[model samples]
Target chain A: DKKKQLQQLDNFIEGVLQEALEEFKQVE
Target chain B: MEERIFGTECEYALFHQLPPPSAQGSGKTAKWSGTSFSENLQEMSHLLVCALRGQNRPLAGEFLANGGRFYIDRGSHPEYATPECRSVADVIAHEKAGDRLVQKLVEEAGGLMAEKDIPGRLHAFKNNHDPRGNTYGSHENYLVSPRAMEKIQQIIPFLITRQIFAGAGKIPHLAPPAFSGEDWLPFAVSQRADFVEHVLSDRASDARGIINTRKREITRSGDNVRLHVILGDSNMSEYALKLKIGTTALVLRMIEDGLGDIPAFLQPVQALKVISRRPAGVHAVEGAGSGHTALEVQSIYLEKALGYFSSHAATGEEKAVLCLWETTLSGLKNLRISPSGVIEDDPGELSRKLDWVIKAWLLNRAREKKNLDWSDPHIKHLDFRYHDLDPETGLFERCASLGLVDRVIEEEAILLAMEAPPHNTRARLRGGIIGEAWGKDVEVLVENWESIRIIAKSKVDGMHPFARQRRSVNGLKANLNDPFEGCNEALLKRVRRFLDKCDEV
Candidate 1:
C-alpha cells in the first residue's frame, strides 16, 4: 500500500512539475 | 523534579510543503516504511541521529528523550550533514553552500526511498542552511527572556498585516487568454494551482484536507522553540492555525520572561514567526515542484511569497504579522477559493458554520473595542450568518486588515475563564474539542485559577487601568453565555465593575 502510494505521488509530482515548467517556458 | 522545559531557549526553523501524490511509492527504497506522517517523522529522526552520530545502523530511539545534541534537516534530505565545499562567504554564500550539500543528500535519500517505493515526495528545509530544491523553508530563533511572551501578545496582529500592498494579486491569471481567457493575480495560477493540484494528489493524502489547521509541533526546554512543516490549504484558516494564533501564543509566553521590545522588522510579519529546533548545524532544502537544480523563475516567485517574510524584518509588534500575512495571502490568492469561503467544498455547511463562529467572534470584539453600537447600519447590513460570513471573511485578508483572530482570543478568554484553571494546556483542550468532539466537560477545567490569578496579578498589578477594567468585566459571567454579544450598556457596566473587583484581588 505504501509503495503504491509513493509511486503515485512521484508520478503526480513529475506531471505537475513538467506542466509548470512548460508554462514557465511558454511565458518566456 | 523531572526537569523544567519552561525557561530554556533554543533556535529553530520550519518548512511547509504540498508535495506531489505520486512520490509515495518512493518509500519502497527507504529502509523503513514511511507510511504514516508521524512514523515518517520518527524514521527521519532516527536517520538524522544515525548520520549525526556516525552510527552504522539506527541507535536506540531514546536519544530523543535524552538531551542529545545533533542537528537535523527534517524532510527528505539527510545528506547535508556534510557538504562538499567548506568555507563560507556572505549569508547567501553560506546558504548556497548548505544548499549544495543538501542537494546531494536529497538525491541520495530520495534514491534510497525510491528504492523502497515510499508513498510520498520528501521535501526538507532548514532555517540557516540552503536547500537543493525550489523554495519553502523558515529559520527562527528564540531568546531566553523573562519578557518574551508579553512582547509576543503586544505584536501579533500588527505583524501579520505588514506586507499588505506589494504582495497581493501579483499574477494576473492562471494561463494566457488561451485557457481561462482572463487575467488573474500574477503567478496565481502558476504557484497556487500547482499547490492545489499537489494537495489534490497523494502527498496530501494523509491530511484528508485538514493539513492547514494543525497547530505547531511544540517543544519546550524552559523557553523552547516549537517547529513544524505544514502543507496547509491556502486560506485564512490555514494562516490562523499555522501562524497567527499559535505563534502569538508562543511569543506571548516568551514576552512574559522579559524579552521586552521586539525587533522592528519582525513586528510587521509576526505570523511568519517560526522557530526551528534542531541540533544546530544540520542543513535542509525546501520547495514544491522539481528536484535539486536551482531555477531562477521558481526561486524568485517562491522567495517573493514564502522566503520574503522570514527574511523581511527582524522586529516590531505590528510589522511582523503584517508582512507575514501579506506574503501568506498573496500566496493564498494564488490558490483558488472554495464556494464556502474555504479551500474544499466537501463538508458543506459544517465548515461554513465554523467559519461564521470565527467571524462573528471577530466582529463582536471589533464593535466593542471601537465603541460601535450593535444597532448601527453597518453592523445591521453585515451578514452574521455562516453562509454570508463565509464570503465576508475575505475582507480580513487585505492590507492593515485585522483578521478575525484577536476577537477569537477574547472569546477564548471567556471560554477559558468559564472552563477555569488547573487543566491541560489550551492546545490539549482545543485538540480534544476539535479532534475528539468532547464538550465543555470539567475534565478540561482551568484547575489553577489561583496560579492564573497569581500570574495575572503579578504581571498586571499596577499597570494599565484597562487591564483592571477587563478583569472586572470578566468576573460577572454567571452563565456559559452570560456575557455574550448584545447585552446592552447596563449589563456591560455591571460586568465591568465585577471584573474590576476581580482585578483588585
Candidate 2:
C-alpha cells in the first residue's frame, strides 16, 4: 500500500506538470 | 400613442435598406413619384400617431401620403431607419422638420440651407463624407448560476475548435458551367469574419448554411445551460461601454470558475487581463469594422477587455473584474421560454434540461473531494486531490487508480439513468417567467428544504440580498414586484428543476 501511494503521488505531480505543459504549448 | 403602440407591436426591426426597384429608370414618366422616401417615413410615423388617436385608415393614409419625398439631413446613425426623398413636395415637409433643429444651431448655417432651399441640397446629407467608421452592435447572453463558469470552461474550447465543422467552407472564384476544373474557389481563411465575407460575396452561397453554422446556435451537449444579457442604454455613462465589454469579462469569470478543459490560449488571455480581481488594461482590437451586426466588432471589444484585465492580474481589484464579467450578457431582446405541458420541441425544452444537468453535476461534484470527478471511465485517475498525492508508482497513485475503477463502474450505472438529448421534455414559448417550462419547474421545487432559499428570499424579501452589499446590492427596490422581480422568476424555476432532478435518482 505504501508503495502504491508513493507511486500515485509521483504520477499525480507528473500529470499536473504534463497538463500544465500541454496548456503552455498552444498559448502563442 | 396608438401609433406608437402599433409600431411597438411589429415583430422585427429592419437593419438594412431595401434595394431600389429594378424597373424604374431615370427618364420614364415618374411612376410612384409621389411615394418618396421622406414622404413614406412621414406617412409611417403619422400612421402610428393617427392609429393611436383611433383614426381609421382613409384619414390616417391621407396624413401619411403627404405630398412627396423631402431631402433633409440629420447626423443620425446609419442603422436608424430613414427613408429616401425624391420630389419637391417631399422637400417641403422635410425642410420643416429640419428647421425645428437647425434653427437652434449657428444661425448662419441654417440660413444658408434655407437660401439654397433645394431638394438636391437637402439630399446631400446622405453623402458619405467622413469615412472613419464606428459600429452599432448588440451583445447577448443568458443567466446561469455563479457555479456555471467552472463547468462551461471545460467545454467552450471544444465548441470553438469545431467552428470549421459547423461552418461552411469558402470559395473565392467562379468558373463557367462547362469549365470543368472546379465549381467554386475556397477562401484562404476559415474564421468567422472571413467566412461572412465569402458567403455574402458568393453567388452560390446558401443563406441557411450561415444561420445553421453560427456559434450562437446552441450546442446540443455541453456545460452551457443559459444565455442572458442586460440591454444597456448605450447613451448612458462609460459604464455602458463597460457593459458592452462584459462578454470578455464573462470569459474571464469562466476561467476563474475553474471548470477546466477550456483551451489553454483562453486561460492566459483571461489571466493577463485579471488584476487583483479587478480587470485593468483591457483593450479592444484596433481596426475592427464598426458595422452594427459585425461579430468582428463585438469580438474586438471583448478581446480588448480581456487583454486589459489579463495584463493586470496581480492586483486586488482583479476580484471586481470577475463581478464585471459575471453580469455580462444581462440584456437581450429575444425572450426564450422553455415551454410546458405535453408540447414537443426539445430546443424549447433546453432551459430545464440544462438546469437539471448543471444542478445535478454541481451537486454530484460538490459531494466529492477531487477537483474533477473520477465517476466516468474516461475520467479515471484524471484528478489530483492533494499536494502530497504523487503519481510515480505509489500507494496513493494506486488508491487513486482503484478509486477511478470503482467510479467508472458506478458511472456506467449513473449514465444509464441520465436523460438523453431533448430529454423527452417539451419547451414552449410563453410570456416572460410565467410560462409552462419555468412555472411547473418552480412549482415542483420551491417547497423543497435543500433549495437555495436565498434566491427565493431575494425575490420575495428584496431587503436582504444574496451576493452582498455593493452598488449592485438589492435595496427595497429588489422586491418581486419590481421589473427585475421577473428576472428572478426564471432563476427560481431553474433552481426548482435542478432540485427535483437531483431528488429523482
What lDDT tens digits, residue by residue, belong to model 1 across residues B350-386? 1211222233333343345445443332332221111
Worst 10 residues of 1 chain B by lDDT: B273-282
Per prediction, the TM-score for chain B is 0.24, 0.21
Q: For candidate 2, lDDT tens digit of each residue in B88-134?
A: 11212222222221212212232333453311111111111111111
TM-score of chain A of 2: 0.57
**lDDT score, candidate 2, position B77:** 20
Estimated TM-score per prediction?
0.24, 0.21
Which portions of model 2 miss their true places by more than 4 Å?
A: A1-28, B1-22, B25-140, B150-156, B165-185, B188-263, B266-505
Candidate 2: C-alpha RMSD to true structure equals 29.1
- Residue B218 miss distance in model 2 (angstroms): 20
DockQ for each numbered candidate: 0.04, 0.01
- The DockQ value obtained for model 2 is 0.01
